[model samples]
Target: MATHLDLEEQEQLDQIKHFWNKWGTLITTVLVIVLGGFAAWNGYQYWQNRQGMQASALGSAVEAAVNSGDKARIDQAFGDLRSNYGGTLQAAHAGLLVAKAASDKGQMDDAKAALTWVADNASDDGLKATARIRLAAVLLGSQSYDEALKQLDAKMPTEFDAVVADHQGDIYLAKGDKAKAIEAYRTAYQKTAPGVEYRNVISVKLNALGEDVK
Candidate 1:
């Protein structure tokens, strides 16, 4: 009976060895792939956190330069932010601020350049739309009427419908196309939500044009 039990145990050991011999490499490969994926995910999370911190710090530098009213410093900090962290929200915000400062200083070319960058590269749809409209305004100021109209002609999100129509109205008005301006203004007023002060402003514009919001 003891010899029989010993033989049975030896048989079980041999079965296990045979199974391992058949599948050991496959099992190891599977484990390596799963573990590698988990490690890669962890590394990505760590890198994203580090990037967010760095971008936040750079954004603070931009805000400081803007506050000091130092164009050179503002330009430097903004350039750094754009070059190093352009994918971050902070960089987009800095672009808008820089454009506004440049515009206010009558640096229309610089303003248009900054706004164009933001309009092209901002991660958020809303920011892109804002930048485009602002760029159109700068073009309109420079009497680049065709370019201004082109900027307004790009596809935009529904949330920008009213504001974009309003901008189109402004462009048409500038072009001495009062009939088109009135039509655009009517579209803007119609799209504007109830209870917004912007709607009232559009109403005033329509009134000035000898047309009421339909």
Candidate 2:
């Protein structure tokens, strides 16, 4: 009986060895792939966290410079932020802030440069549209009517179409093109929603041009 039990145990051991010999390499490969994937995911998460922290730090620096009322500091800090983290939303906001501060300080060149960068590089259409409008205002203030109109001609977000048309009307009026300005104001008046305060403003502009729209 003991001899029979020994034979049964040996037979079980041999069966396990046969299974291992057939599938051991496959099992090891599967484990390596799963573990490696987990490691890569962890590494990616760490990298994203690090980038967010770095971008936030740089944004804080720009905000500080802007608040200090130092135009040169705003320019320098924004340049650094743009060079290193231009793809971040922080960079977009910083660019706009720097532009506004530069404009307030009468640094038109710096303001234009910063607004241009934001207009060209902002990831969101809304932000890009805002930058273009502000840039057009700056150009219009300098009596560059054609250049301001050129900026306004770029594609705008749906919500900004009416606003852009109105701005174009302002540029045309500034350039003494009453016909085009009237046409633009008419378009703005038509596109705006009824009873909206903006629609009232457009109505005022259109009435000044000797036209009315429902």
Q: What is the number of backbone collisions in each predicted candidate, taken in the order shown?
A: 0, 0
Query: 1-214 in candidate 1: lDDT tens per residue?
Result: 9999999999999999999999999999999999999999999999999988999998899889988989889889899989999988889888998899889889998899999999899898889999999999999998898899899889889999999899999999999999999999999999998899999999999999998565
- Model 2: ten consecutive residues of lowest lDDT: 70-79
Show where candidate 2 strays beyond 4 Å. Answer: 1-37
* Number of the predicted model whose lDDT against the real structure is largest: 1
Rate residue 81 of model 1 by lDDT.
88
Candidate 2 yields a Cα-based lDDT of 0.89
Q: Candidate 2's residue-wise lDDT over 98-208, tens digit each?
A: 889889989898899999999999888889999999999999999988889999989988889888999999999998999999899888877888878998898888888
**Candidate 1 deviant stretches above 4 angstroms:** 1-4
Reference-based lDDT, each prediction: 0.92, 0.89
What's the CA error at residue 175 for candidate 2, in Å?
1.7
TM-score of each: 0.93, 0.82
